[model samples]
Target: MKRPSLVLCCALLGIVPTACGPGSDPDPGVDRGDSSTVDLEHLAITVSGRAAVFPEAARLLEAQGQPVPSLDGVVLTVEEPLRVGVSDADSVLGQGGIGADGGFSVSEVPVRDIHLSLAASLQQEGFVRSSTIIFDTAFTRTRPHTDIIDARAWALPNAFHDALTRSIGDASIRAHSGERASTLRDAGFILGRVVDAAGAPVAGARVVLDRDDLAGRVYYPAPDFQSATQDGTSATGLFVYVHSGTAAETFSLSIEGTQAYLPRNAGATPGLGLVLTLYPGNVSP
Candidate 1:
């Protein structure tokens, strides 16, 4: 699939991608220090939450009216910086996978006023190795840590909620101290599918979303176009784009290939789903 430039991709998503380079801190190894001698003022944080299955997989399950697959193999990582007199050091607080019951625990996390980063990863066949990150989670001992997952409130398609809830049960997770709860009101996403003239799934097509107002452009199989080899086309021909913008915005969807699809101009909304049928003729973007 042909890819667009990074600047164009970030603009479409309306996000400034975080830069990682040689000067950046390395992964914080898991902390396993004894808790007995820890300062009495610090509290151990316990984080539990559910993982959403892959988007295409969720859609397939929904179409079949089957139960969403379990996230038993999904892994969750929690990290916070170790602060010195002035500098902060890299340190991983805890990491674990979701249990069969859909719950996960990261015990004995040291209490600190730090920027917490939580990430969840799911690896399974027929689905891309997917991972989502929530950064800058403000954590404190005074705040309830039981609902850590709820606090992150990563925007996900509504169709995936059933499986997520079944895996993690109860969506009322807590946020770290001084953090605001994530609500659907602050969410935005785009769902779409590509098919050939015969209505069969089309894989390896480059999908792009260009903002109507020239605000930015978003490219599918993101991070870079070359990564598309690994992130390209799901088994179901479905593509999902989740962003931090409001649903009120508008965008024009484009497919980079010899053929063109219908309904090029689309509304960017929380649950908007677009079905594009490829034709034989090429259309200019």
Candidate 2:
């Protein structure tokens, strides 16, 4: 049997699917133009972290009893204004070489910009990088200093190539229609992880949005990449959702279609990290 289209699923459930038509602009709230420039202090700081192979690929290999790939040759560049994990601006802070064990550090780096500090994955030909962690800087009074980054990338594994092909297909369609590629960068984003009672990442569990209007605004990593499954959560348990408008949004979350989990009445906001824990379905949240 054929699977349902994501747009159709949302529409059937009373959620407005963004851009349901071919080359349609689903979200009007996304800022199509450049963000306003704000003058801020540039503080030089140290940034360091591990650049591991995408956990999903690793899991796929390990499950099949294959040797996992090494982190030896991947190069990571620190770029300013993390444009949804990929950078377009010319501003770059520094670059670090990954060790065999996926560990690296950059010292005396100048500027602690929001996107730059996340250790933007640079050119590693034939590899697609997943979104890295976004850390808060000194500008915010709450937990300033982001000196560490943990990131993952896929090395053209068959499964990843399949997903990439879907993404390229979507981009090709938009390009053919003369519409700029949609990355949802203008929309506010919420980054999160889902885990079970054992504190282990729940690979296949889906995070269902409670509100009807939030449909079609969420993506696994970003709008450009297509997830391998309709669950919209990656094998490593990361998920993201875009806000419908310019304002920050707080949305309720629940686990769908699984009797194994009883989700809490959790809430998440854009521009921050959220972790949702699931109790046993037989247990109370």
TM, every model: 0.32, 0.46
Per-candidate clash tally: 6, 2
Best by TM-score: 2
Pairs in steric clash, model 2: 19-26, 82-115
lDDT of 1 by residue, 1-285 (tens): 233343343244333222232233212111122212222345345555545554455554677687776656556555421111112353355577776766666666543433223333333433332333322221111222222333121223344433322222122211210122132212333344566655566677656555433322232332211122224454445454433333233345656654345324333333222222223232211
TM-score of 1: 0.32
Can you give the lDDT of residue 83 in candidate 2?
A: 32
- Which candidate should be chosen as best, given lDDT against the real structure? 2
What is the lDDT of every predicted structure here?
0.37, 0.42
Candidate 2 residue-wise lDDT, 162-252, digit = tens: 4433543444324322343333222223445666655566666677766666644444542335433344666556665544323333334
Measured on C-alpha atoms, candidate 1 has an lDDT of 0.37
RMSD of each: 19.5, 15.0
